[model samples]
Target: MGNNILITGAAGYIGGSVLANFISRTSGPIKAAQISAAVRSEEQAQKLSKLGVNVIQVDLVDETAVKEAVLRNEIDIVVHTASAIDGRIPSHLIKALGQRRKVSGEETYFIHSSITTLFSEEGGWPYGQVRDTDTVFEKEKEIGGPHPVRQTNILVTEQAKAHGVTSFNIVVPHVYGRGSGEWRKLSVSIPAYVRTSMAHKIVYKFDKDGHPPAAHISDLIELYALLVEKILQKERIPSGEEGYYFAMAHRTPWWAAMDRIAQSLHARGLVAESKPSIWPSDKMAADYLGFPVLYVRAMGTSSGDLVPVNAYRLGWKPKWDEEQFLASIDDEVQAVLELDTVKATIFDLLTSADK
Candidate 1:
């Protein structure tokens, strides 16, 4: 009977790290129950068992199973870490808090996994599509905008307050670091094109030295450390009245991020480019995307406006470079591919020998 905390999506990219952080804390025994990643596979559960994390299955879609899990586990605190990037928060939220599950001697802390990509789409959102809920949410007077996750963040923030549950909306901006999640895929978002181009040319300056700030995984963990204190110990979370707090570090224009990545690749002479167009060179591409490439080209604009809550004033500053940061990611990709290649070669050789 541990001071049981239930963390959903425990094996995912973000959740895995979060779970690991909790397990390593200086505090005494704080037993955590993590939902396995197998989706529904017993074998995956067995694999998770080897990791020493209390593992189980509780799919949010199945209402009966969810309720039963909550009841059976006597879950004291729930860190609802699951999120669907495609704006599934609305459909899921009602069910998540709708049913009356016994949470005795138990408190719930709902933290949202909303990302910055929601703003990456076209039509300026909610402004164009019917489901584009931007207008409606702003009408409800929620701060922030058109991104679907923005609404999701707002919803969780509001619901946490409404239900007397402690909720905090941790809005992560282009999070990148050692972990394979955002650090790996982020190249596709901001740094990839320019970093890759560095191998060929030298035109990759960051729109006049734009600041492309990034949140290190360690800085993020530090933020969560205080957050855990605020919620569980001091019982000051979900400030019912105060809602979402953006969890991004100040990374500048997207171009700046790209520039940093480019610099690193250039150092290695992997690529080179001078005066490479940071924004979309063709209007057709911009029009097709419907979102402004200016967001990428301009420095200290869009992303800079998203500041975090002062409550987390750990005085944390970003120390990682987008260039080396991303270069390492490139290294990881190459390394993994190299491993796969070796495996393939070994298998082929073995097969030939058998033949």
Candidate 2:
């Protein structure tokens, strides 16, 4: 227990997976207490405690508390996975939905979680959105301008590194999987579309004309485990920067997949008739109107072509691709609907074994 590692956001998606990975790998007694989880809720603390992970309620933004936690725990490795979900649900939107629900809500236009897209401009033509990519995800993609998640990693990683804790930063792209993900980050749009199709008896809806990109839950966990293994094994890997990484998976045209989904839903008798349309009122057309938007995400999702594991040079590798990744989401979504217990199941799995 000499080389203690502190994992932040242990109750959340990526954090939960990271914990699961650590526990799954190291079977026998080893060097360093090796693992501790930090969270805010007492409930989360108790859950993690059950897993045998020392759980602490500390706010990392409070440099002093973070410093104290690291030192008191004798933590040598810190994996920070804390951040606010970017809620695009405006107050008005929520109110409208609530009112609609109260007033015999005839299931109207489906809702979609808003996303921070990236884009790039090249060959004098601009791509509409940007995302996790080789250089800044998109050439000039719409930047969420360095998210708090990335920032927190910096603080924790720097602190650990400064104290001579061999460190690596694992930046996870939108992650979707079982016992993981919120707001469709790792969700493969196809599965969601299929679900929608089944409910409406339609096969697909074309929010946009392109296939979306994604990262699977297991793949994301595997990447983190790889990073931790690489670090504990004392291997040198990139800390982003010169070797920046973005988690990506198989990309497919959105509408086509939606069509397939609708067809499946019809076969299942979940939906009635299908209407092929885009999710958003208008798809990428409006986004392309803005120069900044065009430069960021438009092309990243549509035309982005690169290996996500290149970020592995920075010490991260996900042994997953598009086809398997999409299938996993379908499984997760179906399980959640059928069992109606995604959150609880996630907690049990994460806390059952200490990492």
Candidate 3:
């Protein structure tokens, strides 16, 4: 427990969840005092400080500041969850953390948060099975073609190995369920779909599209804790090509998810129809939802089969499944319904459609 752990995006969903988990861990290789979080604001710092996390206000874009934070703190373990909207992490920070290990002569471990959508982008889903090792970053002729996040992950993997720092890239997909963190209550993708459905009075899914892999926030957090323990124990944690860990419990089909949610709206009399339908066209779907066509396509066609082969090898199991997610649809959608602005938006959409 002499090692210090620095978590970036400590107030965000994934980072905050990791922070909360480590702070509350009763018995582990990490202690609450051994953990610190890089926050961006004094308000966020005050909130985390109350929870016993040593908070350092940081400008994540400033590479010099990021490097100094690691060197000054003598940080041994870094869990990076902060990223751009497209899931891009700073390569400079990766270099900085690696350099810190050399200066302090302390073996450092890094847990980089990536996404399983990389696999789905690789052209294997309903028909073809994809393991963590079957990463699509280097795959040719993908559905969405080349992706920015995939490129970043490949770069980070090579960089971490080049610097001799022990690192694991945890890839998660379609995270659902409520977060235990202090900031950001909901995930971005699914909630957008829910809001769109409420606004359009239609549940949309692509024809013949399969379900995507998904995990609850708590389960994903557990995987992070497990990986932390493995790294601290100096276990032969996989790295490089085999280092990717998929944090998925259930593969929820696109149609099934839309149907459940649409049915809930129908039951509440919010929509006249709850049955799932094929989106007319990529352009039309994009226009209706007010999102880019690429994003809409990514939401629909990017889903495929993803397996947690690496995570299972480490004896980590997910307690939540699709059944739990299905059971919570009422609460999940109702939470969206309760938003005052969301209520106003829905009313306007419904009234406009009547014209």
Q: Which candidate's TM-score is highest?
A: 3
lDDT (tens digit, per residue) of candidate 2 on 1-355: 1345666667766677677667655453322346788776676777678777788887545655664565566554556565422122111122332233334322211111112222212212144443334444233233334432223333333333343233343444445566442211223233334444444444433334544445666876666665555555555665432233445545544554454454445455566654354434223322221112322234223433334554445455556776665455445446535533222222222223321
Better of 1 and 3 by TM-score: 3
Off by over 4 Å in 2: 27-33, 61-63, 84-167, 180-206, 260-270, 274-276, 280-303, 309-319, 326-329, 338-355
Predicted structure 1: lDDT: 0.44
TM-scores for candidates 1 onward, in order: 0.63, 0.61, 0.84
For each candidate, the alpha-carbon lDDT, in order, equals 0.44, 0.44, 0.71
lDDT of 3 by residue, 45-107 (tens): 888888867788897777788888878887888888876223224566777878887888777
Question: How many backbone collisions does model 1 have?
Answer: 24
Our model 1 lands, by Cα RMSD against the true structure, at 9.6
**How does candidate 2 score on lDDT?**
0.44
Clashes of each: 24, 53, 3
Residue-by-residue lDDT tens digits, candidate 1, 304-325: 3234544345344545555555
Which is the winner by TM-score between candidate 1 and candidate 2? 1
**Top model by lDDT, which number?**
3
